[model samples]
Structure formats: C-alpha cells, structure tokens
Target: MPNVRPGEKPEIARLPLFREMQEEQRERIFSGSFLQVFPPQLTLFELGQHPDFLHVLIDGLVELYATSAGRDTTMRIVEPVTSFILAAVVTDMPYLMSARTLTSSRILLVPAALVREVVKQDCALMQATMRELALAYRDMVRALTDMKLRQSAERLGNLLLQQERRQGGNGAVQLKAEKRLLASLLGMTPENLSRAFAVLGQHGLEVDGAQVRFTDQAALEAFSRPDPVKDDD
Candidate 1:
C-alpha cells in the first residue's frame, strides 16, 4: 500500500485524464490521493515492482531506466506535470522500468485500487487513459524506427536538435543528464557519443562541456535531417 495522508490535491485537477471526469468522480480521486516529496537520486521504485500508486510529477525530473544483466540503460526522462506508470496502475502490473528522481521532486500519489475502481466506473477517465496509452505506443514505435534507420551520429545530432528546440529557438541547449546517460539513451557508447559530437562540430554544431549550440541552424539541420515523427518531444 502507498503512504496516504490528508492534504490539498489541486494538481490532480490539471491532469487531462481528470479534466472530463464528473465532479463526484473527481472528488473520489481527490479523496484518495496524497502528495510526497523526494530528493535527487532517490529511487521511487525498482523494475518489476507492482504499482501501488499512479505517480504524477507536479515538479522536478524523473528518470525511467531498465537494467539487464549487469547493464542499465535510460528509457526516458520525464518532466513536470505528467503522470507516469499509468499503464501499470490501470493493468495492475509490475513496472517495466525503475524510476528515480534526477532533481528534488514533489509527486502526487493516487492509490492504484482507487484508480482501478474509478477508471472502471468513469467512462471519461477510461477514454482518456486509452488515448494516453495509444500515444505512448505510437511514440515507442517512432523511437524504434529512428534507432533502426539512423546511424549513431545521426541519432545524437537529432537529439541535440530536439534539445535546442526544447530550450526555445535560440540555438542553445543545456543537457539535463550526464553524457553517460545521454549515450545510453541515444544507444551509443560514451566513446561513440564523443566521436559523434566531434563530427557535428564541422557542421556548425558546438559542444562546450554540457552545453551544445549552433548558430548556423541550417547547416546543423541539413546534417540531422529532422523528422517530426522521430524528433518531436
């Protein structure tokens, strides 16, 4: 069972899944949820652990990673105002990856039992959950397609471009995670990532420690060959 406490839950109201829920249903959800805080590098749960709560990251960063044998790879880094592990909660299954905070975070924990019960009773919630799941599936397919079709350098180039866009169109990017994690996320060894960065420099991509930049956006884009389906965050 998850830790439950009495408190405010205004953050839950902003979730798309709850937007269309009836007032009564929303109250039911509110009554069963609680908020918790965690520091950076704290592991929220390990892979294969059963879902106890549907975590909504109201603030800070969460990294979802998976381990195989002795090696672990970053699966995704989640930003604020999003719900994670919803599929696990709805299906009453184990988490496919482990989650840890990359920065101090405040999370809303809605009990799994309540979510399961409410989702079954609330048609709107059910529809929203299905739509979220479908979007996740499509994203996974797009990520896989990019991995299969692009070379290591191209993958890293596309990622830098995506980050630049995330930081606004200023042609500047500050990587949130370390190079090792970034390499794993891009499916490359650290050495390969270094080589890729060196390659991009010739095309106007600049790397200064953790910051990447490019004033000649056209040149960089020409090398990266940006594709929306693969590059959109």
Candidate 2:
C-alpha cells in the first residue's frame, strides 16, 4: 500500500493510552500530530536516533529489534491500538532499539515535546504513562525468563499453545507473520525454527505452511509443560 498522509483520522483518544487523558490535553497533543501509513519492512526508527514523535499504532503490526556484531534479533512485536518507545520520547534520549513495520500500518505521530508537556500538566496522562511503562518492563522480564528457561522446541510448543489461546482456542494456529520473523522473535535462526517445528510435529503439531493445528493438544501440553509464571500474561 502507498503511504497515506493523515487523511481520515481515527478516534485516537478512545484508545487505552489516550483514554484517561484530559480532552484539552489530548487536543493539544494531537493538534500538531498526523496519522501516517507505512508499508511492510519499512524501518520507523533506528537505535540511537533521537525521537521527534511518540508513535501510536492505530492498526497493523510492528517489530522492535536490536543489532550488534553484524547480527540483528527481534526483541518484541507491537500489535495495534498501543503506543511504543515511550521511554526515549519522555526522557528526551535516543532510542535504544529500532522499529520496523511487519505489515502495512497506520500510526499516529505525536510530537515528543507535546507528549512531555501533556504528561507534566495532566496527572491522568502521567499515571497512564507510568502504568504502561511498568507493564512494558514486566513484559520484558517475562520474555527474558522465557528465553533463558525454555529449550528451542519447548518454546515453539508453548508458543503454539499461546497462539491457539489468543486466536480463541480453535486448536488451529494460522500464523499472521512470516516464519522468518517468527523465528527471529523466538530467538532462533530460521533453520533452527524449522527443526523445532519438525520436533513438535512428532509430538502433536501439524504444520501446513503457515498454518498449524494440534492433533493431540494433550500430548503437546505434556511436552511443552508451560509454566504459569512464564506463559501466562
């Protein structure tokens, strides 16, 4: 899709991040902001780049990633109806990670200066920001624990379980992302992901290209042995 400038704006204030903010503060923050469209694989920002805007994802998906020593890894995937990279915008520091579009996306870009000012003047917005940042931190810790504790195949199995739950427990998982990107998010090479899939196949997972179904979910649960602390959200 071609990138569209702010043409038809959505109800940005209705989103959770902006909902608690005062209308006056919301208007002030959004007055200078604009909605933008981005195509898949486009980089929104890179590590160490100073942030000028706080991006609110109105639709579609984004990938947060970091790289060093000539390699890159996916840190997290941001879904719709949420804001991302708030720390840099609030602290007036450079971004610690880069963001890229995983799908054609709609985003609202609020000026960094206005965001800071609104947060200072609006207590509700400040409380909301603090809550989001706290959740983000806990989420990072949970992800780290999952990476450190689980084996590659175990992780893949648990991920399938989580996906099933997320998609309404139909016993099928239609992957919304490319296997390569999923592999990166799993902290494994694509080849390793393939091998992991093959292992899960022996257990209960049925892989049909991007689609997966569980023939014996009980068996999968046995093999994965998901911990509530790590797997529960």
Candidate 3:
C-alpha cells in the first residue's frame, strides 16, 4: 500500500490522469495511490527493477540513465506534469533505465495494476496516453536520426536553434539539463561538446552559461543546411 499523508488527495487528483477522471474513478485511484518526495540526486528506481508503481512527476526534473561495466549514459529527462514507466509497466518488464531526481522533486505513486484498470475502462484516458507515447516515439526517431546523419558541430548548432524556438525566440534560451547530460542527449562527449561550442562560436552561436544567444541566425542556419535526399527530388 502507498503512503498517503493527510491533505495529499487534492494535490494528487490534480494530476492529468486523475483530473479528467470521474469522482468515482478518482476515489478509486486515490485509494491505491500516494505521494513521494525525493531529494536532489535521489534514485527513485534503479535499473533492472520491476516497476510496481506508475510515477507522475509533479515537480522538478528526473533523469533516466542506463549503465554497463563502469560507465553510464543518460537515456531521457522527465519534466513536471509528465509520467514515466509506461512501457515497462505495460510490458511487465524491469526498467531498462534508472531514474534519479535532478532537483528536489515530488511524484505521485500509483499501483500499476490500478492504472491498467483505469486505462482499460476509460477511453479518453487510453487515447490520451497513446498520444503521449506517439510523441515520445517521434522524439526518439528525431534524436536517433540527428545523431546518425549530422556532424557533431551540426548537431550542436541544431540543438541551439531548437532551444531558441522552444523559448519563443532566439534572444536567450536556457538549457534544462546539465552540460554533461545535454552532451549525452545531443550524442556528443563532454570534451566534444566543449569543442562543438567553440565551433558554434565560429558559426555565430554564443553561449552565456546556461543561456545561448544566436548572434548570427543566418550563419548558424547556413551551417545547419539539410542534405538533399532522393526522396526530395
């Protein structure tokens, strides 16, 4: 059974899955779920553990990583209001990646069995989840393609452009992950990321700590020009 403190029900129900659910459904969910607060750097679940609960990140960020031998690679980052462990729970497999709190974070924990039951009965919930999964798949494809086809310099430049767009303009955009993690996400090593930053400066991308400024958008975009493919003809 999950540990439910007083006054947590309302907070838990405000999460996406419970927000749209009927009162009865919400009640059923709360009956089986609770909240957990993790301090910064805390490991929520280790790799290869069978995930018994679905985790909804309510605050701060969590990073997922995979390891072998003595080294590890960051697999993904989860932000607030997002959920994780869907694939593992749905497939009944141990988690392929371990999750750790990047900052102090609050997460709602619900039994995977209860969630499966709710998903089975609620068409809206099921459809919404499928949409989330689809977007995740698309992101994975884009990241893989970017890594395989683009030079490290181009990948770094493109990531700058993407962050600018995400921030609504190119003037100042902040990085959400640590430099090393961001390097991994962009499929570059830390030293390579530093070299790429110097290369970016050559192409007019200026870094100001966590914030990036595009001093010459045209030059940067020129350096990021797409390659022609047979399909384009």
Local error of candidate 3 at residue 1 (angstroms): 9.5
Q: What is the C-alpha lDDT of each candidate?
A: 0.84, 0.86, 0.79
Q: Per-residue lDDT tens digits of candidate 1, residues 152-230?
A: 8888888788778778878899988889888988889999999999988888888889888896889888987777555
Query: Candidates' TM-scores?
Result: 0.90, 0.90, 0.86
Q: What tens digits encode model 2's per-residue C-alpha lDDT throughout 1-233?
A: 22223344347767777788878877776677878889999999999999999999999999999999999988888887789999899999999999999999989888899889889999989998998898888878867877999999998898888878878888999888888888999999999999999999999989998889999999999998776764333
Which parts of model 1 are misplaced by more than 4 Å?
1-8, 228-233
The Cα error of candidate 3 at residue 167, in Å, is 2.8
| lDDT: worst 10-residue window of model 2 | 1-10
Off by over 4 Å in 2: 1-10, 230-233
Query: How good is model 1 by TM-score?
Result: 0.90
In candidate 2, position 112 carries an lDDT of 92
